[model samples]
Target: MSHSTKNSHLSTTVANLKPSGIRRFFDLAANMDNVISLGVGEPDFVTPWNVIEASYHSLEQGYTAYTANAGMIELRQEISNYLKHRYFVDYNPDNQVIVTVGASQGIDLALRALINPGEEVIVIEPGFVSYAPAVTLAGGDPIIINTKPEHEFKLQPEQIEDAISEKTKAIILCSPNNPTGSVLTKEELIKIAAVIEKHDLIVLSDEIYAELTYDEDFTSFAFIKGMKERTILISGFSKAFAMTGWRLGYATGPREIIEAMVKIHQYTMMCAPTMAQHGALEALKNGQKSVLDMKKSYRQRRNFVVNSLKEMGLDCHLPGGAFYVFPSIKSTGLSSEEFAEQLLRKERVAVVPGNVFGSTGEGYIRCSYAASLKQLDEAMKRIKKFINEL
Candidate 1:
């Protein structure tokens, strides 16, 4: 079929959507040699041996078939136990949780199941790049709220209140946020919760980075008063357990919303991978030490990367969580994309342009410290050299 012929049947939403901004530099890096990449927001650690072994055991036991659309009861119960113990939140395994392909899928499912066409969802940016598009794909308009670094990237209550309109339906929030690595504090959560209560908004709380926090303990939106019934908690084993390739995640929320998402999941994804779910179950049961060990290593790398950036005269805030740092490259007289491109070209160091997250991200670049300390050291050297030359 010719291009125009193919275009005739394409959904306007999918066609007009821009490809992921992170992937643009990632693909560029793939074509280059000796490039040290700090661009991908992936854990460098392998899944723990016990988790992998459990998956192997599941396969050996002939458990490869599709799990219940909501996932295995054992797994859901385990998830329930884990959440209750870790975050002081209670969710019924039978009706309040659904295993998903990843947190990505959970986000999509939540938006798709809840959003009516032309409703608005508030998206805090520089956030995960997928948020706006996911909302748009679900037939909702996205209201972008540019969070300030000065506030450590926490969404201000005023901002939330200002963004609310008659059509506003939900707010997508990522704590221990991607790119910036800022975690919301309890006080901040209280402020946010008040606005949420007043506006009666649903919150899609992406807590994928909850375990990797360094500076403070994570507080789930569900744990706050009256918010549990209004929050969809999307998280997964990808970052915390180093199970990205396994594609396992889940969402826990009010039974009504969970049922809605599961309805969509049944017809679309059916269920998360059976093997991965089994592994995730093992992870919840036995992966605590491994998660702590990885978090320790990440904290060390975070320190090294932050110190290195300061030494090179690049301003970077000490990230409170996640394995990434957002540093200003504005002094180098380059746009985020230009700085990322030229850094890859000249120094063979791959980092993502911050503007890929939002227009407010234009003067910054996000570098993941998830790689080895040695790799980070070397990348820092190259980055310093490149900046000096500029």
Candidate 2:
């Protein structure tokens, strides 16, 4: 095929899509032998027996048909109730929630629904990689504001205020953040709330890790004063309940925004999996104790990995939540990508480079603790050897 002919059929939008840096690095690590990957942000535990049982039961009951575009009413109601019980936020199942294919889909739907062409949206740097591209795909421009390491990679009120303009349409707030694992405290969220409220901007709040807070209670943006009304709360069973493969997640917000999201959802994906919805509903009905169990283990693993990193001469933020430790690699005078690649290739320890997330991630690497303590110990040993050889 000629080069011009091969390119002629591609959508200009997708033709220009940059492949995910995370996936690119991951692919490299995957081919390497004897690699102990601490790179993926996924739980190592099996999905709880109860949740698995629920899915099986749903399948047995022949609940495999396509669900309503917004999702099953029962799951939506359960999600609404769970949010109120877990975060103390009022939500109407009928009008406030839409189940989707994991929190990723929820994020995409929110971006597509809320952003207008060429409008700018603010994303905190050293954050998740998906937010910017999703906004860009929606024909919106992404404005990234770098969060300071001194501030623990937090999105400051001043940063948000300074980033705002007449063209700004939305902002992404990820608490218990990926890569950094920092949780936004209530007071911190209140500061952000003030900024968004002042500008009347919509908030695409990704709280998928909401149930994994350590050292402090989880704070939902939906619970912040004046934020719930304007915030699209994206969450799922992935982090909290080890249900990543289930591909069930949801977003809750104003009815108008949700309806708009459903418009996109109906055209792209008719509905999330029916079996997953049923299982998710059962999870909402019976998964509280499981959440606590996982969180407890994660907290223990967090302490083990963070302390080991410090002992290995790495400066790491003692992240309050999520299952990751973002450690500085500046002393090695290596870029984050180089550090990650060298560690994986030489020491067989695979961690994600900070630069994979955003420019602010330049000198850090993210190590996920969502593995066994034994695995973590081995990973730490390999990492130590990798550092010592420098």
TM-score of each: 0.98, 0.97
Off by over 4 Å in 1: 1-7
Give the number of the best model, judged by lDDT.
Answer: 1
Root-mean-square deviation (CA) per prediction: 1.7, 1.8
Candidate 2 lDDT by residue in tens digits, 262-377: 99999999999998888888888998898899899999999999899899898998999999999998999999989988888889888899998899999999999998999899
* Model 2 spans > 4 angstroms off: 1-7
The CA lDDT of each predicted structure is: 0.94, 0.90
Clashes of each: 0, 0
Task: Give the C-alpha miss distance for residue 350 in model 2, angstroms.
Answer: 0.8
